[model samples]
Target: MIRSYRLLSLLVLALFALEPLQAQLMNKGTIKFEVTDVQTNNPDMQQMIGSMKGMAQTLQFDGAQQQMTVDMMGGLMRINTFWTGANSTVETYMDMMGQKIKTIMSNEDVEKMRKESEAMIKSEDIKYDKSVTKKILGKDCYKAYYETDANGQKFSMEMYVTEDIKVPNSFLQNLNQIELKGTPLMWIMDAGMMKMTFMATDISKDLGSDFFKKPEGAYQEMSMEQLKQMGMGGQIGF
Candidate 1:
């Protein structure tokens, strides 16, 4: 009886040890990332990059609702989009110059953006180096290498991603155009004079429904065309 009791206790401890691992592999949660660095070739852009340093962004996934939200710029800008079913509204909220602005993109607008992005991805040389793996934010991630040539400017990129925590692949299209088996945990992009890196700082299951809802208050609404003319359409992930 003593030996049986000891074996039972060990079994319980082993199961408890696997609990966190199971949670980490679960497909539902919110992941927080920080912009550790940003580099650019344009001197003017470099000056603006300082405001983005140490900036934090949160990507929340609601498996039940099949929706996701990317909150960046210290919550001053948020892009909300859906992954499953038909959601005609892709909403973004931005706080600019003490004014709250809400930008709405229709399903047609999002589809157009997707095609343009797909073309851009096709133009790049992207590959995965699975042999390289690192533990980032306590989760294992693999490396991906790629190069981008935009407007006659070429740059190289290295990204770390993990397949353990699953989320809709479409959710990452705005930041990354390549098709990946995992979610990016860290990235280092080099464009001669410009460089930028994003690192995941936290991953948790504490996401709430409220995180996906629009902010409470008056907001000036703008259509996709107006935002594009203002050179701000991309800010909303369009």
Candidate 2:
């Protein structure tokens, strides 16, 4: 009987040990990422970046749909993006300089925009390497690289992504028209003169349906075409 009790105790402890690991793989949670590093040679830009350091991005996902919020220019510009795989639609709400603008696009619209924005970039431009691997929050991650030319300027980025966080493939339009197999816990962006590293700082499961609600209030509705007409195409994302 004592031996049986010992075995049962060990079993209980083992199950307890696996609980957190199981939670990590569950496709529901909020990942808070912070701008951990900034590389720039401009003194004025450094001061600007210093203030932007307080800026952080939050991504909330629950397998079916996802919402990402990004703050730019020390919160002078805020972009909130919501995508639902069920309806295959994306809604972007931008709050900047006292102007509230909202835009909704269907999957077809997104693909069309993807084509125009990706005239110089294509899916083949992204490369993934399994040999390059690391650990973020105890999950396996691999390296991937993407490069493209923005008009005449060159853009490049590297990501350390993991398959542990399962999100819908339709939600993959954010990474420059390329589909990444997993969520990126760490990524480095190289934009010629400035470089920035975004790292996931915390993950929490304290989310609900209410968290994904559309923005309320007097947000002026705008179509994707009108947004581009204003030359603020880069201010929002799907």
Q: What are the runs in model 2 whose C-alpha is more than 4 Å off?
A: 1-25, 42-48, 72-77, 149-152, 169-176, 234-238
Q: Among these predicted structures, which one has the highest TM-score?
A: 2
* Candidate-wise lDDT, in order: 0.56, 0.63
Candidate 2 lDDT, 46-83, residue by residue in tens? 66556446457777877677777776556766667777
Each prediction's TM-score versus the true structure? 0.74, 0.76
**What is the number of residue pairs that collide in model 1?**
3
Q: Candidate 1: worst 10 consecutive residues by lDDT?
A: 13-22
